[model samples]
Target: MEITDLTPAERRVWEAFPRGDGVDFREHPEDSSVDGAGWGPERTVRAEVLRALLLGAGRAEEGRVAGLKIKGARIVGSLDLRYAVVDHAIRLRDCWFERKPLMYGAQLKALVLGYSTLPGLTAATVRVDVVLRLSCCRITGPVRLQGAKLSALFLQGAVIGPTAGEESDEPPLQLNHVEVGTDIIANDLTVHGQLRLNGATVGGQVSLDRARLLAPGGIALHAETLTVGTDLRAHRMEAHGMVNLTGSRIPGQLNFAYAVFVNPDGVALRASSCAIGEMWLRNCPPVQGLVNLRRSQFDLLHVPAATWPEKIRIDGLSYRTLAPHLPAQERLPALEREESGYLPYAYEQLAGAYRTAGDEAAARTVQLAKLRRHRRTLPRHGRAWGLLQDVTVGYGFRPLRAAGWLLALLLVGSVAYGLHAPRPLKAGEAPDFNAVFYTIDLMLPIIGFGQESAYAPAGWYQWLSYLLIVTGWVLATTTAAGVSRSLQRQ
Candidate 1:
């Protein structure tokens, strides 16, 4: 590890470090042996020595490292003690890198570590400058950069591996309270590990906020107490495992808004103890997820004047899309006045789950409650009451004409009975014995005596007049009652 016994190539790498101040990394083609292949056991020491020397020279103009490579030597021995000062942003593009506890506690400027594979590299407590872009990097061991200050940290298209085993002492990627600058766009990044940002404070907008974590994958992003400035836009970020952020504080709107989670049977976003300015999980299409904002508060009153998606899938519930601005009177009326109460379906599902587990009383209570609400919210006087009345009036009251027909029939019957009178008597024939007997017999029956009528009684036409009067009143009363009830039903 001494400088006196340095080989020719090692000597050149060492000499360049001290002499290459303010050097442009792009100009030095020999700075990074990006295409360097396998290294021999004997040559690795020389190569590593040169690597350390290059790092010691510190950064050139734009924080670029010159001749940075290891060319695969099994990574049994420690390498690269000198923390390469990246004057320009460091680029590890196309480097056949193999790190084993190397760069363990190094300080450097912003890193553009991408298109490279570093298996066991550990940057435990390194303080990085603005913008740590790690696109398409395959990281195996736990990359713990706790207390690292990353301004525009992006990890787009990177593949991160998980911890070794249960007893493995590797800490999760702890960027705990690491302050980020403007945007943290990490789209299409896959982390097969426990990505923890327990208390990270991103000063600006945080945008992981599309990274995917496959399952039975271990712990996903746990930004529990992370703080954000503006929007946390994580749209369509799929995680088969859990993404627990129970106590995160988002000052602006949390826009997972439309992010779809795969397995919501697990904890999706547990913001139970978090504080959000506004929440926009409006139309997420998760098959089964739980956005447990149980005790969270939404202080941001103005949740963008845009129309929100009505329906969402939560814990096996498929909520149909609805207008967020629906008037209280307009939304499908639920018995509960509180908006939270509108989640009866979800409640029922939970209750059913409980009930299926042998909690009979609880299950019955939930089902009964739903039934009561359904009945309570039913519209008054049936659905088509008003329409039926309108149609009745539009048809010109044919009901009234039907009543007239019944009345006319009764009047005709009375007229026919009178016209078929039993007697047609001569004007002066009363002195005849036979005629007198017949007239007295008819008179007895008409006067209520128990005898057959041989002739009709006097004033029978007057009786018909009275029948007409009664029929008129009956028809009028019935028509009035039907019309009154129809109008009053409104």
Candidate 2:
């Protein structure tokens, strides 16, 4: 089929085609020459109106329909022409009207609708692999790309919807940003990507599900400065390179569920200055990359672990969603690689996680490891002395220390009484309370042996010293109680 300029008879044929659904015009070879005289006036008008209806219906023929002007055709309808082959890149620039255009469920080679002025456009299930550039176009609807596949899609600098209005210049119900691409850049655009919105304003969900970015140096999808009113979901998106989102403000959740980021040099989600509602990065295992959220703000859930190996330096943050599933040993590499100052902090969280999981032995082991690391920096004597005290006096452990202190005080008092004060009646001998009383007489020796004066010299002096020691102990115990309570609560 060859496409020639529209003649008066050809125009009549186009007009004769039904304007309703399930109607299509046959494909003919498109004349590359830009000759308007061939189609004339009457034929041009008929072709223009018919072309609008066909494109709107997704019923446009594959071959070519060139040299025919079809601008500002207000055909309120939906399009669904899938697997249509176009030899040349199609152009639909600056075409306006009220309707939901369905380009989804279609397979095109190349599209060039750049600088096109459109209002209320919706395309879902569309598949284009070559190049689809709609740069700087004004669209007033949810330009949805639900389940679409594009090689290089460039909607750069395009205005998705109007400001100060909820009703999109087009219509609502935009599907998610579901595309597999070599280079897909939709930066600085103001409109939600995931859903068909009511207004042209940027407010809805954005999903980049199962999308693969094949680029190496930079990211596959670049959506910076996107002011979302709802969630920005990127589930199962595999990027072979860095995914840089320098500055984006989201009013709702920023979800990266099960996303694989393969950037070792750079980060996966570098949202340095974003203001998110709730950030969810669930089930994202440790990657050899950074997800730096430096200076970013999140309202609710903050799963810092889910965003692991990501250099997320949050200055002013409200992170209530911090749940660690992995133990401290597993997260050390990530902490070191990211050079996070919160390494110890993350370790503390891991300890808590183990405790919460009812793994007391594991928790104790982790804590002991931390203590050993801290002890390694101390002097040898101090470390040895501390370790000795840890076993003997139980160090800071209250339950064992309490019993140990009681027994130590008893032994000291008993020995002091025997050596310093010998009983006169016994004649060169002193009643050994420790042996006679044994365990049953433990309390009597501890509290009373030093309380009374003995016949041996230095009796009053020893009694006074003992009283002072008891008083000193009471005061020390009180102070220790206060310190223990304070630390335990914190």
Candidate 3:
């Protein structure tokens, strides 16, 4: 479009473009002469004229619109670029917009809106070949990017909040189902509402380091079903509500080290069913609520035992390895910190995981730890029974304890019968009894050697006979149970 044919607002934008030189606006003078005509802050443009200028520039060579920069201008209306394909990069710095720009289904090379102020942005299904930057900008309403595709999204140091006079609670930034070729860096961002990225697929990392999100009593970050090819780094993130990443798949690590979560009565972090390569929550700020990791799988876990929240739900959660090699004393206590006393199956699962990783010593430690915690839950008198099971049979893991008791009992009985021999009851009964044979009869409950009927016991011997009978029954029952348990485990 020729300058003469353009509208007054369009003419101003046309005049703002540099002639042939590829100098960026950042290097240009604040009050540089435009098209031999001097322009100032008073040069406001309508959104329609800006759109037309972009369309005209798209038809030109790639660098023809390289320095097509706009600054200190107030856009009068919504800049609707729906379905428009622009080839060159667009940069709008220090600009103000009356309403949010609508870029639904639009295609662009790159978009930069640094130090700009807008009510919001709606770029649903829009595609950007290069970076989509909103650095140091102020967004007042929801920045919706549902189904959009971009190389990277940079919102570093941006301030996002609710629109003026709006009190309804909703997400301030939504990237639902969006696909990014690279990272989404939002470090130092101050978000007043929830930042929802549900179903988004990121080829690279999603870094929200040092970001502060505020959505009290609700979800501060919701990334359910998100697929991240690399790490989700949110180190030092301060969330006022739950940070939910339920069912997400992260091929790389999920790092949340030193992050602060403040949802005292509810779930502070929920990653149920997630599959993360590794997880780092070591030295995290005190979480006031529960951190639920039910059914999640991680290759490695780095969490301090003392830093565990007041409540945690780890039912079915398994990690292939644990960092720093927490001893059973520390590990079991952490698992016991759950509000619901103790979960025996959780301990079993962890021990099984350890065994699968070729850490049998750790597995046995965990198994014994589970037994100890379980003993605490039993009644005072029942705890003694449990202790006996542990010491004698190792909670059915050591069947040889029953055999040891039986052998010891047989020895004691042999010595007692040898010390005081019994006499035959009938005159015709020839005494064919020895100390060992007589003791065997008393020790084996199901078998008989005719010793108890044929030979008569004295006062002390009679009591000893009764003691041996009771010991035989106890050992036999325990041994049977232990053997059955070992078989079942196999």
Worst 10 residues of 2 by lDDT: 19-28
Model 1 CA lDDT for position 264:
43
Mark the regions of model 2 whose C-alpha exceeds 4 Å error after superposition.
1-201, 297-307, 310-318, 324-432, 435-482, 485-490
The residue-by-residue lDDT of candidate 2 on 1-490, one tens digit each, is 1124545544444443332112112122332112222333342233244344344422334453432223322222333344444333344444333344446467765665555555544446676667777666666555666556666666655656544435333322243345544444444443432222111224345555554444344554455555555666666666666665556777877776677777787765567676777777677666556667665656554454445664654433334334444555654444444343433444454455566667655555455445455565679997885565444433333344545555665566556555554344445464443421332133333444522322333466346445546543643453355347436734
Q: Candidate 3: lDDT over CA atoms?
A: 0.79
Those runs of model 3 whose alpha carbons end farther than 4 Å from true positions after fitting are 1-13, 16-49, 57-67, 71-77, 163-168, 334-344, 368-388, 398-457, 476-480, 483-490
User: What lDDT tens digits, residue by residue, belong to model 3 across residues 195-301?
Assistant: 99999999999999999998889899999999998999988999999999999999898998998989997999999999999999878866888999988999888
Poorest lDDT segment (10 consecutive residues) of candidate 1: 301-310
TM-score of 2: 0.46
Would you list the C-alpha lDDT of every candidate in the order shown?
Answer: 0.51, 0.49, 0.79
What is the clash count of model 1? 21
Clashes of each: 21, 28, 0
Best by the lDDT measure: 3
RMSD of 1: 15.7
| Overall local distance difference test of candidate 2 | 0.49
- In Å, residue 325's CA in model 1 sits off its true spot by 3.9
lDDT of 1 at 129: 69
